[model samples]
Target chain A: MTYCLGMLLKDGLVMISDSRTNAGLDHIAVFRKMTIWNEPGDRVIVIAAAGNLAITQEVIHFLHVGVTLPDEEEPKTIMSVTSMFEAAQLVGAAVRRSYRIDGERLEKENSGFNCSFLIGGQVGGDKARLFQVYSAGNFIESTADTCYFQIGEMKYGKPILDRALSYDTKLTQAGKLALISMDSTLRSNLSVGLPLDMAVYHRDSLELGMHRQFDEHDPYFAEISQRWSKSLKDAFLALPDPSW
Target chain B: MTYCLGMLLKDGLVMISDSRTNAGLDHIAVFRKMTIWNEPGDRVIVIAAAGNLAITQEVIHFLHVGVTLPDEEEPKTIMSVTSMFEAAQLVGAAVRRSYRIDGERLEKENSGFNCSFLIGGQVGGDKARLFQVYSAGNFIESTADTCYFQIGEMKYGKPILDRALSYDTKLTQAGKLALISMDSTLRSNLSVGLPLDMAVYHRDSLELGMHRQFDEHDPYFAEISQRWSKSLKDAFLALPDPSW
Candidate 1:
């Protein structure tokens, strides 16, 4: 399993994905799940995927090749989409291509041809945007009411994000929030492991700014992991234990 | 969907179940999911269930009417089983019976003849114990390394228990931990709603004690809910912001 989340904030968009995939407990492997399509200063589209690794990689491959959505004048790939919305459509088309290729065989085996993607970023003329594309090739964009989208092993990491994130949160604080959320996911679920991929996008910068990979040995992640665990324990201990 | 948990500890047993059940989001209803079978001074058995409400109710009824397991004695009911292990077997027998009656019809409709139960408590000459009974009527007892079992909407509420619960935790502390776990579930999941039914049994006491129901208006529950949420937010704030 994997966990991927994207948030479209006032500052821009933040995206994170875990890099572990397991067909079963014995088949666990590491595969980076984040892909960046960038033409610095023109457009920067980031996609974080979860579900079948093969399906997600195929979707990205389809996106890198040419595809056209209805009403578009040209065959546009992720790198050519004029706005974040078109970029989302391009991603959805890719997912559809994967479905066409593997859906029947996967269904016969009782293995779903399932994959979902968190696509977010900005083009030269549009504001930052984020979307969650489903296995069916349809997608939903995030708005003020729903500023974040999570796919995969989402439940273990959700309470913190539900309580902490908002569209106006500062980028640095949002980065911390995202890490703590990842930290919670890491501790509760063995299916979701590291090295985690994170991208912190600043508003209106049509370029991917900060991207990092975190493993067990990464110092900053090590500090965040140790510190967050200690903080949770300390906070829990500090709660007034009920006498009743 | 539902969420129920049972924990076996040195002080005795702790079991908690949410009241909500939903066939679908629009078809949600509330029903008590806990059943207590006690011979007072001889034994105390608690079964908390999740999955199809009808199936669970039928299993409870079967146990009440005495489902005989493949054993050396006359059909022993939960109240008469000498060891906690055998009592779990009695519950498992009921699960199998219910499945035999309805499994095929449910499968035809694409719904699982699905149900599971967490059974625990001390019986006459035995130490406290916990077991998870599957839809197939097979069961697994909780080991020292894994002292708790949860069914239904479990993930959102699991991190706290993973971090805090152990075989040696006091009954009172276990109760607090259970409540906090339930609180997290109630907050994040609409499918796992209140009022909650919780029971704490003392080891070898063969009696159920300390039972409570927490609803939206319950005073102590309201206090714990507010305080826990505050602590989480406060803890998040206390973490340093990312610099890079």
Candidate 2:
């Protein structure tokens, strides 16, 4: 299990992913799940994936090498996509390609071909966008009414995002909410752990604004974790006890 | 889908269950998921269920009628159980009996025999106990270190419980936490909804201390829902935005 979140705010896009991966309870490792394709001033594509590590890694490999859609004559890689929409389509095609290669084998072993991706960023003149690509390879973009997407172990962290995030939120504030959401997930689930990868892309910059790795001992993350927990406790205590 | 929660606290037990039952998105109805067998001064047994409505209903029926264990000649009903552990066993036995009657048929339909239960309360000369009965009819009791159980649509509501609940929490406070947890779930999930049924049992009282049903119009629930959202937003704003 893993946790990855992407928010498309009015100011920019904020994306975060955890580094824990596990084949089972006993076999766990830190495997970074965020990949960036940045060609400064031309395009910046970011993808955070969750699901079968092998499958997701293979999808990333396809994105790196290139993918050929049925109607296309030439293969297109993430770095070469003309627009954010093309980037999302390339990701979907890669997922489908992975399915064609491994889906049947996995089904025979009773393992579903599970993989999903949160792809977001800017490409040249196109507006910044965020998309959630499904295991089936189909994808949906975040709209004004729904400006965020979360994949993997999402529920524990969702209430905070649902309550706090909006399309009008500032890019930095959205990053803070994403971290708080991840903190909630880390506290409740063992499969999602430390060393998070986060990236902020300022709209239309066609370049990454900020990218950082957060692990244990990261002071800002530690402060956010401690202070958020304290605030939740304080808020809970302030609620009046039921008189009945 | 449903959400049922039970907490075993120093003061007693707090149990809450939603009343929504759905066959599919097109088919939904309100059916109370909680049942209580109160034999004053002898025992008080509360059962909250989640999963296939037919299977859970059958399990509840078996509990009410009686279940005869392999080693026992006489069948036992929840009200007849002497200890809280025995009450759990009775509930488990009821689940197994339900499986025997419908599990294979449901599996043939690819439904996976889905059903689980949260059972808690006290019996004469016994302490208050909380147990989460699984689909297979096995159950685990909550310990001092982990004094709560939640079944169905549980993840959205879990973070608050993990952060706010404790074995030493007062029963009323635990009830408040449960309500807040339920509010979070209700906000995030359409499958779990209004008209919640909650029961609180004071330890050694051998009877229910308080029982209430909260609907959409309930003022206190309305207050908690609004205030908690405001508090969470305030807390999020209080966290410093990332400088990077």
* RMSD after CA superposition, every candidate: 1.5, 1.0
TM-score of each: 0.97, 0.98
Model 2 achieves a DockQ score of 0.90
lDDT of 2 by residue, B77-131 (tens): 8878789888888888888888888888989989899999999988888888899
User: Model 1 residue B49 lDDT?
Assistant: 93
lDDT tens readout by residue for model 1, B35-86: 8876788878888999998899998988887778875546766666678788
Retained true contacts (fraction), each candidate: 0.56, 0.90
TM-score of chain B of each: 0.96, 0.97
- Model 2 global lDDT (CA atoms, 0 to 1): 0.92
The candidate that wins on lDDT is 2
